[model samples]
Target: MSATTGAVLLYDGDCGFCTKSVAWLDQRNLLGFPARPWQSVPDHELPASPEALMTEVVLTRPGRRPLGGADAIAACVRESPSRLRFAGRLLALPGLRGLARAVYRLVARNRYRLPGSTAACRIERPG
Candidate 1:
């Protein structure tokens, strides 16, 4: 696939939890797309503002709107090996989509407390 059509996963490099998660995906070869730390990605390649990016993972592909949070996770799964595609579809289903997003938000908000996470994983909440 062309670079524009290929999916790219952008995540927070400074967060230990985030780094570990990406490493897990890489170890399993479960991510079909290239993953990059948001800090290392040039501004022009980013689909959203830096502040927004810090709040959640983002999946970007040209000619389409960027997918954030749980949606990005679903998209990554769908792009993974055939065996895991079903789970990805399930996550994106209308009925489960909202729940998945909520869970993702919850986990994101408390990432600093999760295993492998460090103080840098603490996200600043907006007022």
Candidate 2:
């Protein structure tokens, strides 16, 4: 770990499940990357609306490119230990990418239904 420029994780602040997930990542020290609530990221800093962020997990790799949904998760894993990185690479295979994307979609779409999310978790766009 040579202090690589960490990725930025933009997530929904009001979703308890999302918060818990961020906490879990933090606990694992996987959140070396900046973790910003979707609402907090300045409009100019974000390439899209907050509503777009709410629809997916956006991981910005500063000066490079951003990853979203399953790709974001994979990128996070790749930035971790060697074993996890290998796993992430394995998932990038054609067939596996589809499966991973499908899984990510399922979790993302129903995140509000998971334990911890309340009606207050509705997505809000930044002006």
Candidate 3:
């Protein structure tokens, strides 16, 4: 995540996949997007319940409404520098946006099984 001001990206700190993903993006310096774990963010900083945040990554800008998951990523990429800006454009293309959302959901749902993730990353199904 970006360390500079402007937009913020919030992720699950306890999840290995989430943390690693954040770190990966952080190192890339994606247009100064401030990334932090929701666990450390103040309640007043969030637009919704922590549980809701836990379910998906969130992107928030000062005046705009908070966006979640793939939409959040798309918004962030759109604001990123030229090199990575193409990703945001791709997300906006017709038909691709829905595909991106579907892919994001699939990966999010199965993140626990991915490498680097631990049991803590597993989201249990509701009984």
Models 1 onward score TM values of 0.91, 0.79, 0.88
Best of the two (2, 3) by lDDT:
3
Window of ten residues with lowest summed lDDT in model 2: 1-10
How far out, in Å, is residue 126 in model 3? 1.5
lDDT order of candidates, best first? Answer: 1, 3, 2
lDDT of 3 by residue, 62-115 (tens): 778888998888777777764887888799787999999999999899999988
For each candidate in the order shown, give its overall lDDT on alpha carbons: 0.85, 0.72, 0.80
**Runs off by more than 4 Å, candidate 1:** 1-6
Q: Cα RMSD (Å) per model?
A: 2.2, 4.6, 2.9
True-vs-predicted CA distance for residue 21, candidate 3, Å: 0.8
Check candidate 3 and list the clashing pairs.
1-26, 2-33
Candidate 2 TM-score, C-alpha based? 0.79
Model 1 clashes, total count: 0
What's the CA error at residue 91 for candidate 3, in Å?
Answer: 0.9
Q: Tens digits of per-residue lDDT for model 1 on 94-121?
A: 9899999999999999999999998889
